[model samples]
Target: MNLVKLSELLEVSRSAVTQSVRRLIKKDLVSFEFAQDNEKKYI
Candidate 1:
């Protein structure tokens, strides 16, 4: 999910989601990609 949507869904601040996503990416625990529609998708 996008940062803003994720933050809203998780009821957290955007910065918090940003930090957690950064960590997850660094650890390779989560991944994201742009679909054919050019929208971000998480996997």
Candidate 2:
């Protein structure tokens, strides 16, 4: 899922999801792929 959608579904701020995703990405728990539009998608 993407950060914006995840945030909306979770009823949280986009910044919160962004921070969490960043941590997970750094820890190698989640993988992020970028689309042409420069959105991050988690896998």
In order, candidate lDDTs are 0.82, 0.83
User: What TM-score does candidate 1 reach?
Assistant: 0.69
Cα lDDT tens digits for candidate 2, 1-43: 7778899999999999989888988999998777777666755
lDDT for each residue of candidate 1 in 1-43, tens digit (9 for 90 to 100): 6777899999999899988998999999988776676676544
**C-alpha TM-score for every candidate:** 0.69, 0.73
Model 2 ranges off by over 4 Å: 36-43
* Clash count list over all predictions: 0, 0
Q: Clashing pairs in model 2?
A: none
User: Which ten contiguous residues of candidate 2 have the minimum total lDDT?
Assistant: 34-43
Candidate 1: pairs in clash: none
Q: Highest TM-score among the candidates is held by which one?
A: 2
